[model samples]
Target: MNAIEIINISKTYKSKTKTITALNNISLEIKEGELFGLIGPDGAGKSSLFRILATVLLPDVGSAKILNYDVIKNFKNIRKLIGYMPGRFSLYQDLSVEENLKFFATIFETTIEENYDLISDIYKQIEPFKNRRAGKLSGGMKQKLALSCALIHKPKILLLDEPTTGVDPVSRKEFWEILKKLKSQGITILVSTPYMDEANLCDRIALIQNGKILDVDLPENIVNKFDKDIFSVASDNMFLLLNDLRNYSHTLSCFAFGDSHHLVIERNKADENLLIQYLSRHKNLSVKKIEPTIEDCFMQMLQSEN
Candidate 1:
């Protein structure tokens, strides 16, 4: 069964001088017990779409349903069935860690003990600082606390918006581990993130940009769909090398990836020797055929769109 359904949903923000579309005819379905990811960079309308699903914001057009409850007409029922952790920390800063969790439980008419098993692994990490004010905890600790509160009611679906953003790498890893456990227990998860590497961790992902979904598929499938031959080129002068590669006659697309540049040329048109001789003037030059990654696919999609 599908846990969430969004059909032709659209949202826009207007000010005196500008009108910005946050979502443009978006439609998607997330299956029950699936860990789905909404992948995109900042200002890509991830938050706006999430807000609509969480029933916190109404869509300007179309409609959404969570667990079969219409977001507009059945918000109260929908709210009771989902756990939402917004991109920002929304818990009470003045409340102590325990207080915040208990407060949320109270609002849902449930006790932490009743759902203790659901949040036990996460709560234990923050229990030591239970008496500490929420504002006094570190970023990672704050994240754990917020998650614990979100799960306090044992909601069937979890909507986590950039939950790992601004968190330390170690904490991010730990948090994803927690998510895996939650998925094993049959909680449907829809997580949004700008981190391309994290896309692989999801069961399926939707890549979004400028309020539009570029593609949706398994990470490996998306990478495999990249049809062009790409080579990773590196030289002593990285900046100059990038400009030269982009200007090369056979170059189709070239983008800097870490210390090297990934260059895509007209398929099967350039040999290693030809590329080497062309770049012979550069010192420490190296070029090797490489497979495309999720980020590479995303860049290629964006380039094609333009």
Candidate 2:
């Protein structure tokens, strides 16, 4: 059975006279035991969709199901079988690390000891400081505590919304490791994040933009779909280099990618010898063709979809 299913789900919020559509006609199916990811930038509606699936908010239209439980009608049952970690840490500030975990377990009518093994790997990081107030913990430590509490009940599905947004790089890697471990336990997982690098970590992902689904597939597959010869160029004069590339008749699209700029050939235009000599004569820069990455493919897809 599909772990989660959503059909043409759309959510809109009204403020004064303006109506903002947070989620469009979004439709997706997540298989049981799969680690599915929702990837997009802020205001792309990743959190809105997560909240709807977690039964925290209702869609303006459409239907959704989590493990065959209706998100709208079976709200109580759905809430019991799902573990939700929002983008922000919402644990009790005055409570200690151990106290917070115990409080969550009690809400689910369970004890921390009963499900200690489920959170042992994560809990161990903060267990030594269990008596410390949760508000006093570092960002990484707080993340661990929130995740530990989420798993205390051993829910059937896990929903994480930008769980690694502000955490350190080391902590982000550690968090993904925890998700992999949880996936091995057969708990279907759905995580959403604005970070492009995190998209590849998932088994599959749906790239969203402006409340719309652009493409849904494995990260490698999406990159493989990119058509056209792409190249990368870097120079000390970044601004001048971009302008020179744009003036070239053969350049299709040129955008900065970190220290280098990525370029696409202008339709059927492929001439390395002539292009190099042209840029040398014009921008006095070094350039070479390079492979496309997920971000490159995303740009292509976005432009095409638009």
Candidate 3:
């Protein structure tokens, strides 16, 4: 069964002098019990789409349904069935961690004790600091507390928007582990993130940018779709090597990737020997064929669109 259905959803924000389209004819269906991800950078309409699903914001030109309930007409029912954690930490900062959790549980007409098992794995980590004010806790601790409150009502669907942004790498890993546990219990999870590596952690992902969806598929499948030869090239003069590679006749595209530059060349038009000879002036020059990553595919898609 599809837990969420969105059809031709478009939202635009208009000011006196300008209008910005947040979502552009977006349509997607998320199956029940699936862990789906929306992958994109900031200002990509991720939060806007999430808000529409959470029933807090309405689309200007389309319809959405959650668990067979129309988002606009059955908002109350949808609100009760889903848990939403916005990109920002929204819990009352002045309240103690325990108080925040209890407050959310009360709003849903349920006690934390009733759904303690659902959140125990996450809550226990922050339990030692239950009396601490929410604003005083560390970033990772704040994340755990927010998640505990979201799950306190035993929601059927979870909408987490960029939950790991600005968090430590270790905490990010731990949080994803908790998500896997939640998925096993049959909760449909929809999470958005700017991290490309995190895409592999999801069952499926939608690559969104500029209020538009670039592609939607499994992580491996998306990587497989990149049908170009890419080579990792490095030289002592990194800056000069980038410009030199881009100017080469066979070069299709080139971008800096950490210590090396990923250079895409026209099929059968260029080889390592030819590149080596061309850049022989630079010291420690090296080139090797490599596989494409999720970010590589995303950049390829963006290049195609342009």
Q: Which residue ranges in model 3 land beyond 4 Å of their true spot? A: none
Candidate 3 lDDT at 31 equals 94
Query: Which 10-residue window of candidate 3 scores lowest in summed lDDT?
Result: 265-274
lDDT of 2 by residue, 169-284 (tens): 99999999999999999999999888888988999999998889999999889887777888888777888888888877877778899888888885357788877776674444
Query: Which 10-residue span in candidate 1 carries the lowest summed lDDT?
Result: 265-274
Residues 1-306 of candidate 1 have per-residue lDDT tens digits of 789999999999999999999999999999999999999999999999999999999899999988889999999999999999999978899999999999999999999889999999999999999999999999999999999988999999999999999999999999999999999999999999999999999999999999999999999999988888899999999999999898888899999998899998766887888888888889999899998899999999999989
Error of 1 at 268 (Å): 2.3
Each prediction's number of clashing residue pairs: 0, 0, 0
Model 3 earns a TM-score of: 0.98
Give the root-mean-square deviation of each candidate in angstroms. Answer: 0.9, 1.6, 1.0
Which candidate, 1 or 2, would have the higher lDDT against the true structure?
1
The best candidate by lDDT is 1
lDDT, candidates in the order shown: 0.94, 0.89, 0.93
